[model samples]
Target: MRTDPTQPRLRPARRGRFAPSPTGDLHPGSLLAAFGSWLLARHDGAEWWVRVEDLDPPREQPGAIERQLRTLEAFGLVSDGPILRQSSRDTAYREALDRLLGSGAAFECWCSRSDLAATGGLHHACVSGPQAGRAPAVRLRIPCGESVAFDDAIQGRVAQDVGTEVGDVVLRRADGFWAYQLAVVVDDAAQAITDVVRGADLLDSTPRQILLQRALGLPTPSYAHLPLIVDAQGRKLSKSTDAVPIDDANPLPALRFAWRALGQDPAALESCTDLAGTLAAAREAFSPACIPSESVALHNTGVAIAS
Candidate 1:
């Protein structure tokens, strides 16, 4: 399905998403990821979607979802479709889980974190079958030596043996909350996402997601993992660190910094007077070739690694 050399690469029907979990204000690292996905989708003439991953009621702040979207909107990175929230999509996730469960590809797991730790999480001993008395967690039964490999848009060849390296992935926690891996996999398929442009931190998780997609007979979207923004201490910048929020009222400095951090020549945008101009110039200049394979440190962002 290669594009013709004489034609544009974008399709009007092509879709991308900047799915975020609402936990706090937008910071530099989070903004960088959002801007990256937004810029790429717009550059290719694709429809970009915003999905709020608000599945975890306990961790999510009361008003953080609206605030996060407002921040992206303030920075001119708006979604093309009606915003989708995971909280409203439980039926979809459950259906997908049911498919796997009925296929015998998923099973009830009763192993606690401590139980898994004691048995070496990657081994067969860690996978406890359904127990009558205990609350059960749903986990995918990965075939042994399930070696999956894919070429990343930016990071290049990535390969993972999920069965050995990651063990069985939890689809639903004992608390009954849909697991991040399963929810994200189901949501991406539901949205018809053509590409996934996000931080490098989630690169390792892609194989697990791909396994789920295959088990459920869903299409796997192309992936591009941007370098992560870290701090002076080399720790990934995140909400847990209380990352400083970016100022949406004055976004130029942060945009410029993000542009450079993504390996683009920011000097070309010197003539652009405003945020729109900067964005316009970026649409022309955005190249996966320019983005680096490794993660780089950015000062702050009030969120954790998102994909």
Candidate 2:
């Protein structure tokens, strides 16, 4: 007994996610990122999941997550699966840390602020100090002369040597919270993400992520880094930057703006009166390769920048 030879090979479903920190409301730049990710996933007939990156409690605003998700919904960017919150996934992260520690892929760093600045901060375990009763930060050991490279969807071929450019990166902070680099890598693997589409500002972090993936025996996904959205002064928009929140009362304007900013044609979408119809049209007409250029500035648009 054998399977039919003419049967097509079954491919696993592609998974893409939009993980935003709950530090602020949805700005135009973040909206653009979400829009691009949504279009790509929907166009591919893939799963689009949303993850709340609420790792740092101190930095998170009280109600920013709810506002952000509501804003995304008003723009017709609904997620496919139940939302995931990083704050609730501490057990998984701890297990991953234990595995890394057992495998010697991670080490406790005792480097002080002054030592890191003085020693170029590229090597791990360089300043092993008093570990009497303090919890030292955990750092990944980047092998020397290691080159991490990947072909990006938008930015073309990108490569970096983590050992040379960036030394051992912290996985856990002294404050006992998991570092973003470690948490993101672990969660991406756990979620079985197939592609990562996000702002180009995080392009530099890819190499480190790839390194972690390999070390942790996790799968590395394809990446697409969109151009950073800058303001009139060429400043990138973020919680720390000057970016206006998208008003939910009139979401059409901001939605159209984000669509155009992602390099999507707005000729027909502009006529749409409803958010769902607009998103449907954009998704049907989307082509990942057609998103021309990288950066978009919203200096005079009375909106935020593009990313």
TM-scores for every predicted model: 0.90, 0.93
Model 1 is weakest, by summed lDDT over 10 consecutive residues, at 298-307
Candidate 2 lDDT over residue span 63-141, tens digit each? 9999999988877788888899999999999999999999999988777777777667566456668577777888898
- Please state the error at residue 238 of candidate 2 in Å: 1.0
Superposed model 1: Cα runs more than 4 Å off = 1-12, 123-133, 239-242, 299-307
Instruction: Give Cα distance to truth, residue 144, candidate 1, Å.
Output: 2.5
Candidates' C-alpha lDDT: 0.83, 0.83
Roughly what TM-score does model 2 have, to 2 decimal places?
A: 0.93
